[model samples]
Target: MPKPSSISEKPHRSNTSEESCAQRPHQIVIVGGGIAGLEIASNLPKRTGRTSIAVTLIDREPAYVWKPMLHTIAAGTSDVSQQETSYVAQARNRRFVFEPGELKGIDRQGRKVYLSPTEIAGRRVLPERAIDYDTLILAIGSAANDFGTPGVREHCLMIDSRSQAMNFNREVMARILETVTARNTLNIAVVGGGATGVELAAELIQLADVSAYYGAAGLRDQINVTLIESGPNLLGAFPDRVAIAARGRLEELGVTVLTGARVVAAEADCFRLADGRQVSAELKVWAAGVKGADACAKFEGLELTRNNQIVVTPTLQTTVDSRIFAVGDCSSLPVGDAGKPLPPAAQVAHQQASHLIRHLPRWLRGKELPTFTFRDFGSIVSLGGYGAYGSLGQFGLFTGGFLRGRVAQLGHILLYRSYQSQLHGFWRGGLIWLADMINSRVRPRIRIPD
Candidate 1:
């Protein structure tokens, strides 16, 4: 992240029809184009003849990729180019302004946000600019929190973003190649037994199988993966049966599962456990917890939680400034768990974003914003190509049931497709799904990077 730039410049005012755009309450800036931000911008009207609201979405990256698919990218099972959607095209088609820059700070009193210059490949792309908005929405999602453990950040890789996940894939492939050439065993340690870690461990095994198919036979026997969970069970959020099944599946795939194994610290090529045991590995990954970006602390005066997540009310409005809102992994809103903040999940953010599409227009009319309620549709944890488990509950309905196998796996894929459908509409989303299917059968194994 860059330092906060000057806020002397103001955003351009809207000069559209008076009925469609308001002059004073003109710009509505949305920071972060993750699942939440993109959905809101796509659903919100670009121009309602009856009102004025100029929408602007700013993010450090120029594209959006579903966060859950990051593990696949990390395992070399998916391509980043195929998974990413161009933000500029989305903005142009959806009727919003797209600004590419990293958010550094916010001027709450002045109603403006400071965006630092955008850089790519060590080259400057977009210069710093100030975006003034009567209403600002922060959807800047989270990153993997290492809990300040010694050597965690220095030694472990995380799959919290597209780039990091891709980097992990490259590293894994490079290590596998090294082991193949040296005729040695490759050890891998995935910390935090959460959904991401579990999925990643399983996917790595599947990736090894694919590598064998691509002329790297005997790679599987040379690769060893360990999944470490501090909790008593994997997928602690899911039912015990789901956890048992997931652990069983991983074990069947030859993954070493370590429960109640808390990592006190990470050293180069090894992790020190709380019980004084050490787990050695050639590669380590941290997927333990979620926390807001450290850069968000520079937002100046907004109320934030210990994790640096913006503290928001039930309506997703920032506690300190009603004009500013937050959702997704970046928000800490007291919605459930005895006034504790809601879990930072994709579903939570999706529901909140949907609620605003209906309520934002009312907000512009000076009417009361309706409260939001989150209904969990359960969860699905896919164990690579072997199987998936968990439960699915209907949205706003009275039906729920446990699921497994292909149905569960398809359910996971459907959840991602639902988001794509929401963004690109049904026709395009359907086509993309078809294309993915075709590519799966027709495309050969991915080529590992050097």
Candidate 2:
């Protein structure tokens, strides 16, 4: 309703405490509070006299926003306030201690992790500290891998975090306003044919349509979206027909799809391809691939992949240490006798977290950990109003077929809600869902970032 504020403003902390547990309970330290870490902390049994462990979750951010929803955030179609899970509040409610800091290094022999100083509002908020653990879990998640492309770090935008998504929305809004003022078109280039890139391109068109409906009619016809992919088709992981359907859907929505296009370099306003094609745009987004956080490479003597993902065993334990476990996109563990690591998806992390929940406590009790397995279940690709498509099974024993239109979209929403319900109790989750539905009706359809 008012002019949007900058998301770069220091995040406000809430319900935070710096004190450690008084009792000498077995310390279970969790680094990185993404989906896996949050679920693991929430699902842990409440501390009673019976239990003798204290769970501590550490992360750089004060809140956790679902990574999959970043596209909608970038498009200004969703407000983050209702979605972001506050780490401090979650810790208080779930009986875990929350520490905000970036991982500096790990001492494998000492069973401790060093955290860099945490700064807020241009001042030292939390000083450098060390936390010890009987068992440690690393679920720090992954970041966008520019893959040595020139000028990419400076020129390309990535929607990998809440702040990044908010910044992207601001950029999109600024571009739209400029286009409206100039009565000209604004071209956007999105690299990668993966789900993020495809979903983002589609969501931007929806943003244009929403802007047109709400007094930005002059800018509706001025937004041009170009999707570039190095692969042969969109959604390369999906079946050929499904990928074709996704590409066709985007094309039907006026998106320019360039398949088999390799981006060799990124410039301020243009990207040079391997085939000598240079694509010009006002804004460029890189969402092709991901690697573990930069700090993963500094984990003492931990084994890591070329992309910096920690090498882990089938039980999700790091190859170098059994006490330390990695999950989500940051850890590379083999799957299905394929000699390849598990796919980077939230579902994989979710299932893995659930498996750890069953085994982690016992693992601390001298029980041997069992090998972890994953179920494919299926993959769903959203195309906004154009439609959604998904396959039921490609990896697991369960076989499934393609789902289209509302059915697929409904599945997408339901899956997200179920995740919320899993974290919060059914009653509270239902109330939160109702609140979101009500907010959609009461608030503006398109919201600028803060």
1-450 in candidate 1: lDDT tens per residue? 112111122323343433443335467899999999999887777434466777899887778889888898899888777788898999888888889888878887666799888888899877888887777889999988888899998899998877788789889889988998998999999998888999999999998898888778899999999999998889988878788999999999999999999999999979999999999998999999889977778888888889999987777787766778898999987854578787888898899988888777766765677677888898889887989997765565534578899889989989999999989889989999898888778875564564
lDDT, candidate 2, 321-378, per-residue tens = 6667898889998766568888889899899988888876665555567788888889
Candidate 1: TM-score?
0.92
User: RMSDs, each prediction?
Assistant: 5.1, 8.8
Residue 409 in model 2: shift from native, Å? Answer: 0.5
Please identify model 1 stretches exceeding 4 Å from their true place.
Answer: 1-25, 46-49, 393-400
- Per-residue lDDT, model 1, residue 258, is 99
Q: Which pairs of residues collide in candidate 2?
A: none
Which ten contiguous residues of candidate 2 have the minimum total lDDT?
1-10
lDDT of 1 at 140: 90
In model 1, what are the clashing residue pairs, if there are any?
19-51, 20-51, 21-51, 21-52, 22-52
